[model samples]
Target: MRIRKKRSLLNQAAGGDGLRRVVRKAYGVFRREGLAGIKTRIAWLRAGAPGTVDPRRYGEWVRCFDQIDDATRAVIRERVANFENPPRISVVMPVYNPNPQWLAQAIESIRAQLYPHWELCIADDVSTDPAIRPLLDRHASADARIKVAFREKNGHISAASNTALGLATGAWVALFDHDDVLPEHALYCVADAIQRNPEIRMIYSDEDKIDESGKRREPYFKCDWNPDLFLSQNMFSHLGVFQKDLLDEVGGFREGYEGSQDYDLALRCAERAGGGAIHHIPRVLYHWRVHAESTASGTDAKPYAVVAGERALNDHLDRTGIRGTAEFELNGYRVRYALPDPAPLVSLIIPTRNEPELVRECIKSIVDKTTYRNFEIIVVDSGSGDPATLGSIASLEHDEVVRVLRDDRPFNFSAWCNSAIEASNGDIVGLIDNGIEVITPGWLSEMVSIALQPGVGAVGAKVLYPNDTVQHAGFALGLLGMAGRVHHHLPRGSFGYFGRASLRCTVSAVSAACMIVRKSVYRDTAGLNEKDTSMAFSDVDFCIRVREAGYRNVWTPYAELYHHESATRRDDSDLAMQARFDKEVQYMRTRWGSLLRDDPFYSPNLTFDEENFGLAWPPRVGALV
Candidate 1:
């Protein structure tokens, strides 16, 4: 029988969508060939594996290959031969009834580390398997670096981890599962990061999974320290190393959060050591092992793990004084922040020309679907040539909360939005296009919650096309010269690279079609620039200025809206329109040239030619300063 692919198993485990799924189809492949099969597969991967989703990553690995060559190993040894202050890393391993074969592989991976300054602290939680205790004893006797402790009773994973933590004598402790494997240069990478940034207290690296056949796939190329994304899910699960002092300060891992103990510990550590103390090493250093009973195969392996994770997140929020509640959504969590008391009014501004049908739908969705009560609509109509549009505009006058203002000048989207802003009276303002329709009922509430957060300048919602394809998720600067949406045209319900399309991560900017900005922040940043009469890049310019004023612009997938984008606007195919667009693009390049070249939220290793989030042709090297 032909072997099944890893993706099929992942889809089955994730119920057709696997943001956190690990590869599990290699068991039969590994069993058939044994050790020879594992070696052959890795060799094939180095030779540019066909049908690989991320070929660039494999290509990079082939070049480096964790200093396997004698010459490369010598160079690495020379570099760290006489380090001034080398920090010892304590590997905390909590073991139960792990597969003997896989368990040996895990221990061997640590023994193969290039970095010499480390110790493996293993706590066996009373394994029923008779082979486990003898194996631990043999390894500890052979290697002085290996320390073993046998539990008197079968404590859960949290207690077992705490027991291992007690054995840690190093300044930093790194979490390692008994069944998982580590790269040869994992500790070396950690040491290098520490050498570069000595102040780092918490460090995490990107990771992937190894199938039973030793086929490495499904790499998660994560972003830098993303607090918003952390609240949603445990992005820093693998290769997490924390200062032992910081862990002690947080009182170690809580007992009840068994399956998600690492996530809970990470959150607690983050609460104590923030900003520069938190660091990210964007490289796959850990390889999770996926088996039938492993949590990597499915969350259902430990049903209570999901519940415990939610409780951990809620506790983090309460301790941090963030007024919100976290609830489970698929394989992740969605945080619903409680709206401020006497909710600040949000002025919804829509710029329209004639298109009566589009404008009507936009207004209807806002009135009927929006659940946020403290909001007023301001319609800025620009020279309605059709009498039907005039009637539609006059009809809204009867609604006391909706105000229809006129901009009799030529069609300039920026000027129209500015006019509406001046005429509106609300604590917050939303610049929405006339062709947008609300999809999520709690859209306004989600936007308001984020907008009202401290140091947040603007909040952008996920805008999808009428046919359920993504119109705009968030903007990445330097993409297509000025900026472009990260996951534009991606199918709905599909998460983009590393679940970035679904998670609430920060972006350089977001489209103003359905953006909410605080009135104070808008005034502080001087609102939208009206200089670009063609109206292109106006929203990007506004967001950049907002960030320059020391505020973060955020994009949330929770607040969703269907955007009939460009429905009312004239096509830029004509010579005159194309010339205006060129001018607008040129104006943006002139004003923010340096910023357009580099976007902090986006990684340098990613492609700028397209928004596919694929690895660049020549991946960036060295540490990000």
Candidate 2:
């Protein structure tokens, strides 16, 4: 080993070719990943790759890819000149007592835009600071596009925003903060996306936080138009844009939700323009200034924002007629859906081979710990030779809620599940593995509430290993060319990556180990694929089919359960099993091409290396379009 190290140093030291190779490799990483990506590669060589990449270093990323050179300005100008009535965006900013330098920088960022079809409308909320009005007047005098409105009385954010909205004449309105900065190409990108997707009425982009020294950090590379996640947190806070008609339709923000005025406005607009009318640009367009008072520093800075956000979310739920209560937890909101008048009967189907102890624990936990009153257990045993296990199964039938199915057939998991569903007498069917045990008493309640929703297909839980580490949060497709668990191996109660693991967001698929689905929809979507995926990939395939049938599969971190997955897991070293696994992979690729490769809930900026929401080394997206 010592000689190899010595030879390596000597080879690089002998000629410039070796050093050139090192520089060339770094340059390649820059083209793929940004400037921080070079440091990521070095860290991997020094201490091995981290479980998740440190997604900071926003300054490096901006310099590497988001640089607006003269050539970029020329392109923007040429593109705008050729357009037919390219949108003139009206940026409305609500102001109070802000730092003078920061306010000047915010106004200057608007003046330096490459896309010239924009107007700035500023409304001052009776600031006590004397510097506010003079600075505003200087800017209004300098540029014909800048509009300033000084409020006579002290109104809050919502009222101030509406005052600024009254001065706007453009077709679209872009929400802005008094101290925040927009990139030179921000308006250009929004206009470009509008031109491409003419039906879209609302749009937002990724954002980051800038400190007093103008250093950027904490970049938030967000997903594409996630409605559930939008309820939890206001991802549309920065770079949030809307059509003037939609803004007017929502009545231009309510006065009560002062701190979370944007969130409330977004919810109302989302109700009007559902999923089909919104677009997301995967680029950092807005920079929120971080200081002692800004929420970007931490939520503790503004406790009122959290409370107002909850109120806004609860009001959104009521407006949509969803019978659910929203509560703030883990830095996001969790909605507890109410069960129907006659609580839907849940039939939990547990398939076992010959494991008696595991089966007994599973059944005992459901009977002892589960708080849900109306449910039954159906144990499907296939060819169990142990007489003692058979005797215990027969004895379990003495209880009215426990039913035993004696099916002495081949070990086909999919076939057993379908047969169990056929024999079950309930409105909802839960496909639970025999090795899983209940951790939370309200586990059944959470799953039933979500699965009982109209368009929701499969509802999964937060499963943990016996050691209290995460076993499965959900399924992320394109993980090593197949599906893998999201937030796998995270310690219990870990709020991963912008609190995604803690939020009930949409997923492409979920594990069958602990999932619940409505019986009517399950049968209509054609329950698991039994022929080609009898053993493996059946759950993912079933979920894909369900999504194709216009039903969304959901995964929640609220329902906690202990999954002894290793006990039921089998090694794939045998040639026959390996061949079958390869065939299933090929079948999935041929059947679902892009959908498997790209998950809507998962970002292209995140890596599939560990499926743990790490920043992709050279993200799938590039600079502004």
Candidate 3:
């Protein structure tokens, strides 16, 4: 390693050949370690911190080729063939003027599948390239399982995909791009998943990008059946297998949504499949080929694709009766839901005591910056003995929107919040910290829009620290005994863990600090446990209970705020406070033990020790129940 670095430095000093060598070496590291590894190496080269190239894993994703030895192939083949009910999967391909070499590889991938109970259904989309039809025909003639259909007219991807779907005679249909390659065990894995869960109607696997040189990179480790994540973007683009019945129900793919025809179909299929009916195989089954003309290379290759994606999302929202406008942003769709008719008033319940200046700033921001008009501020004053704080509360009583509720009892955060909820006339309740400063406009509106959604129980905003690092982006369970904030200290706009920090998605919990929940949902869970967790884990407990009551908790980066509180500077000196904290932590473990052990939205493959979505040292696997 020392010699390599010395050589790298010597190469850096020299011109042309030496520099190219250094670059190639760096690129080699990049290919092995991915973007995070490359970033670490760059930092080290820049004389930065001690973050060096991460030690390579024994059987990491890129080493998939090596892992698929003859022994592994034999095991897969045996497992697949031994399955009692092996569902026939029809591999559907919509061919265009793809590179002949790449197209051949794609076809061969299907041919090389370990699971033999499959057929290849090819639909030629009237490609002007004379070579495409003949190539497809020769392959079809050679293989009995391969079926070819030539389109009379030039239809786009949507029509072509539909034609291919029509040709499928299998129980399930697997989508395959013309230029993409599938792993040999891909069909076997899908079959195994179906065998394990007979109810599974839709299945998707993790995928990576393969460049022109056939080097795999940019592996996307996706979560299982995340509805909110799916709404944000089509996470399941490759190796998507759906039951033929579900495909027929959704009518394959829509004709006009050419670029995002698959996305449209997936959305429709999901609506029918339900969240539980979909299965995710956490393996790199598909390799999307990246070429100059491919969307995988860049969205700029086909800008119309972006427009089509937005249209698909909008149409999905409309069809699902969700009042929202989906806009194309950050290579994904951001849906800004329309406010309900005669917009239900939201009660901004803030608990504070003797912090006049802070309360004043908080109130001022709410009045000045809040875009949503229908809101009432309910300040749950906790025995404010100071004249300044009392006077501040008194002054706020004049405004029709502001209402001061005095609670001279013991300082119980959970109790205060519960009391405020009871007092609130509005349908929605917002539990905001006194120290939070509104950073984004329409913050309340965004929260309310999501909160009002049919099954959403609680909505949390992206809370950044004063230094602009993330304080909270929804709370993840099992991080610190009870829960920890997702992307806790990630820099602003960094898009931590596959854009999870930025996108509005489902989570097990969201922090009470700047959290919004429906009044009815709060009552359903009997609000927070004031006695057990007055200061800590109350919000986590409440959110979990809300989820347990069959509602989803959402966290949105759109509604941004700056949390003034520093979690690091927390004073544990007071023995009583420490004891209370310990008790609260214990209470959380006792109440929601299983939930704390596993968070569905946050994949188990991800690390819990660190907030960043780093690879788990020893990934957890479920025992056969």
Candidate 4:
């Protein structure tokens, strides 16, 4: 019945004339592998999970922002004229048996660039297609900027890419594919980013897929430089431009990673990005041609790509000295960083009121299920009046691992957490809500491992509701003013927007309901805010402070827990509570100022109206420049 319902959803989602073939294939998956298989299969078939977005929304967005009128082109021309000494950008392409039409289009896109400072360096890997050489020659003859080299031997993509690299004389190199089409302003944007940030070592832009009919869709409007997210999947694959010196230092793309050679190269470059040398342009600069054979169409087309990506990530993990295991799952990689030898004692603090069952569930789940051995629990009871709740608290006081702190203060969550934090002596401190029940036994192991990372400030678990729907994957700024629930209500095990829900990536914030951080980090940030955001938005404020203190706040789905609290059905009807909530929202608006509006973890192209990565009706980006 679940399989039938999922198939129905897939069939319904696979609407429009273009996805009919995918729907037919999806039925086969339902018969063979059941619900999980069909879910993953449909994702490949649809190119992405079917979010609550109109299918033609990307097309509309492109028409509004990507398309350039004569007036806009004139403006771009004038801006180009005012540019400084622009560095020569070498657009390197490795050709090997590409479609005649696509190869032609790719070359034409380079020639059509608005910026005139780029050189197209093409290396053919002994194409068996008889007509390929003439086409390359024709383009090479047509434009002096276009350089072509016919390889004597049939070297793979990595070898061919190095050959193209050998031909580059420019200080900056842009990795271009033989078949993908670049926008007219693609090189212009790269050049613009380079000129603006002279110290920038690498730059990449958002990209989309183009089918055989030239219609574009699946625009991946990505966020700024996210090192953790990059480790999960190659977010910097399209319009990937790197300073030649960095490439020379890193020794470019490696062999045997043909399909994900670019991913490998980016991972290598990232190690030396010097914290802020990488940049992301929030625009679709490249159009990945999707066909039966292209990876843009599906990962199954080249299963070796997934294997290569897994190996590449592992290679990176090994090089970086991170004690972790990388495994490929759901078209992305999951890295389980090992807990340090003699795992540091973790202090779990839970603040509860009159809820006895919720408290018992949270405590028992942890006591029974948590695999991380060295941990102590502190339950901060703030005026529990119910007899049953008091009895439950009295029973817990006798437990060796658990301690009760009685705080009869007016319900200030920050005060309770801070009070408990002060009383704890563990290296790592966990802020668990009374209603948060452990779903996975290794939840503490995952959180503690991530928290111990020197650069990480806070680690959050994948929080789910009672019915197994996502309560909070992570929190982002400017969503519903202060804190927005990311991937809210998405089903368990589903990939949300290129693995946003599933991937262990950095975010603006995580819910304190199931968050962990080093005690030192808590001390560094002065703990949660109690004065302004005493009750609400304190976690968000604390996270912001943590990030500002030069630490990344990460959210991972591997650490799963059930948030049994009625977060969605909060009845803040009291006049004082409502007034306090309003004040907290205003406090964030003033305290953070521009930071709230410009969350680096989220794209400006995305809407703040909701947290689902929806297209902003009028995107926050300025007119094409």
Candidate 5:
């Protein structure tokens, strides 16, 4: 009996050892192949275990592996060697009085870049620090790439950057702040991108936030580069890489935009580049150091930053000949516009099939909430099975405020919207989905404010779920497949992974759910594509065309709405809907390849599951509910 018990104990020990081996091997596979590999491992283990391993426990194990794998990959990329024959890049960094050690560290990080063919052009704007000169000289002596240029008189950052720009001889110019660090592969990655896409005059990459200790805190902006968005917000962090010629063409950076000089330069470049050809490398290549002295760190510290951003925005408007006003204040913050008049007789167009209740709510919201009173609600019905819908419309007391148009051809969202717009009388047109409910009282005023901005041709409202979580903040090209879903529900007011507002962004496309467009722009873009007769990406197609016509498409958070997201129409056949969605996606991919592929607003980090259904149960309840 004792011998048998000893053998049993020995067998148990062996089994434990075997389990460790399996776990280690599983982790190894996960590290190499990511989540997919861990899933495969879970299946393999389950197949062997049968009732021994609980499916729930196995899933937990897989999750562990995935986290480990992601961390491993991040570490590998952070340490990876860069390209061979690294192209020469001149980084123009401007410094005022920055932390001595932190500034030294920032310069040192540049020196540590894997790419050898790069120069650090440090332009000091008469820094108050007495110790700065010796430290700059010490680093310059250590590395040939480091060159220090100081202004005897204070010229501020804009002048300092230009001074460095004048010295840049490299093929590519990368703008950096004195407190920011270039990841080891920043120059190398830029060089690789330039070599790959010769036609691209500028390339911007993703960036991360680092604290004063130089420890990476979080990724600020993770989406791909978007030019239309570049107009409204400076999406490209760590500045960006510009072809020296292109930089010179735009006359370097504008002077008045002292805090947001880089933003001004990017907008000017986008205007010059026209559309397409600008590249956004999705990887996090730049590290923006956040300290007490960082402009974004304190409100008092960067009052000029906001002013500079506003100035840059105005400059883009002026340069592009975009008709709009700037510094127009509403609800405390300044809202810029191009239109002189507020009550321009906007025609609110509603395209619906059978949503009588929704139509009533939508029309009522327009009448009740809109600050600008000169507007007409025009409902274009495709075909409604419910006779009550027609009855409800007939029963409305204000017949003068409501007009109904009929289309019997087919259930095409785009076609219906176009028909409504055609029937409307106003030069300024607003399209709202039947399922949307306006939340803001001055929603129309806010939208028109942006729509009337000099360069803005199209404007979309910030759409929220009925539950109040974000539905569609903005639209981007190329998110059609992996994150092919539109109108993501994000955490309220949570600027996503990249300091990008979960609230506002400019994009190549926006949802027809709540879009405002000028009459001329609507006619100029030839209305929405009628060929896309089904419910898919017709809004995207229209916005792309509008952008092609030299107009900006903007998404404003000021105009808020609750979108019951396809609630008016139910897709009984999932298979058919998927097929139609796939076809439209393919169409977009083929026709607008560059925009779809390179748009910075397109975030790869957002997977299909995360974007469409949003974050899972429990945790999402507080924010989403």
Candidate 6:
């Protein structure tokens, strides 16, 4: 005869009192059957009988029973008797037509781990292979930590990942894939990182790519934990241990990102994480399988990967409220900002001695191309004896937009700038050389954005030579005898050693040729030092004071301008220019001392060897060609 378990306690009650009889009946049922039989009977009873209990609470109880077996129950009771905590972890893997041998290898890798405090939850999309079920069963039988759930229907990678994530139960969740191999120390590394930095929400490490025969590949893209690079590209290996709370907060892996889910996750995590919350392990703990089907192979085969990357970038910008246009082309890989609505007031200060044509071109460009609306021009005439230079300033049709300040005391660039600043009413102060010609629209917007960042004291533009070669990418002091030198002269498109068109580095000073400074910093710095005002070392001195006061001086390649070198100060006698240059170098050497002598960016060896000034500046020969 087929035996059926009681569907409800009320039906098995032996007495009239419902509560007391229910307890007695439960005890009798447990006594009559073995643990497995009782579990089967309980499963049947719950299926057949409905309860009015809260669904959430009842579901929790159901999950507890589902995870428990006869041996586990006894162990739990013993642990409770002895007062011990249970080990918990949630291993989430999303599979799509996974190879049986590779899947088995992945499972075996998990089984071989020293820390056996984990559970494996696999979300398998529908596959046509007949060997999958038997293979899964063979592994599941060997270990209770392994659990497999086959979807009734086929889902994409994102949906499959979410399905696996839904089954997590541990305090932490680990992301794993079907074909990847984890080192024996993988779990231990994660545990150690988490233990050290408990406040960190996620941890990732470097990974090696192995071929089909398990041979390591050449030229690996080593993982970097830089947040800036992370936003631009996926520099972190994906197999990371994430806190369950942070995972839930981000709503798990976003769908529709077929191959770039990890990239998307890294960007989102960086956006939400506070300072230093995301961490990196400098060792390779995960082995990525580099087969033909891998996403990193190329975008041609997996076009969706490129799409996903673009989508991730767009989403990051949208979420962060960063307003700029993203350009991904060669020589144009930068985000240029559109002019802000009701643009902030700017005061354009130009110190002129006797350059009429260049100053007129500069003013015309500002009036013609500048999309920014509110701004005034302050021309500090530092003893311009040329009648045409004075006439150009007097010839402005809009006199209301232009103000001329006469400086008859001396030709001090610093003091002239101070006079201009005193005459200006704008919050942002721009100092442009009389020899510069603005070449781009929205140049002011780009400058303003960098200056507006907290703690940023100044922003300078990318000044190019009249021959179209880069003149000054940015300025770095102590680089070449404490004199500020331009960064990239590499034949147009080279990224140089810094891996950027405009390299980001801490500099002793930026040039005052075309720079933007906040009004408050100008006030604080006392408007530059006039002690050495033959225009010799004033910019360097100002930048030093700015840094000493704890402010960052930035150089951006976003704003482009053409510099007519030394148009106002005619030191055309090569000896005079050389003498002036030597004096400035001497001043820097005396001020900075051993710091200038030890700069890595400068090279005495190349300076002696190379005739090319370009190669001599960077100290590395043949790198810029």
Q: Pick the candidate with the highest lDDT.
A: 4
Q: Which ten residues in a row have the lowest lDDT in candidate 4?
A: 9-18
For residues 191-282, write the lDDT of model 6, one tens digit per residue. 65665577887777655555677654321222234433344446555467777788888888898777678777767776777436776664
| Candidates' C-alpha lDDT | 0.80, 0.82, 0.79, 0.83, 0.66, 0.62
The local distance difference test score of model 6 is 0.62
Worst 10 residues of 1 by lDDT: 43-52
Q: Sort the candidates on TM-score, descending order.
A: 4, 2, 3, 1, 5, 6
Comparing 1 with 2 on TM-score, the higher-scoring candidate is: 2
For model 1, name the residue pairs that clash.
none
**lDDT tens per residue, model 3, 288-382:** 99887887865555656766787888888888888878865443567888887889989999888877677778888889877688999998888
Off by over 4 Å in 1: 1-68, 383-391, 409-411, 532-534, 567-571, 574-577, 590-600, 623-625
How does candidate 4 fare on TM-score?
A: 0.91
Mind sharing the TM-score for model 1? 0.86
RMSD of 5: 17.2
Clashes of 5: 20
| Full candidate order by lDDT, most accurate first | 4, 2, 1, 3, 5, 6
lDDT of 5 by residue, 329-364 (tens): 111123345445546889988877767787788787
Instruction: Indicate the worst ten consecutive residues by lDDT in candidate 3.
Output: 46-55
lDDT of 2 by residue, 587-617 (tens): 8888887887787777777777876676666
For lDDT, candidate 2 versus 6, the one ahead is 2
- How far does residue 123 in candidate 6 sit from its true spot (Å)? 4.3
Give the clashing residue pairs of candidate 6, or none: none
- How many clashes (backbone atoms < 3 Å, residues ≥3 apart in a chain or on different chains) does model 2 have? 2
Clashes of 4: 0
Of candidate 6, the 10-residue stretch with the lowest lDDT total is 616-625
Winner on lDDT between 1 and 6 is 1
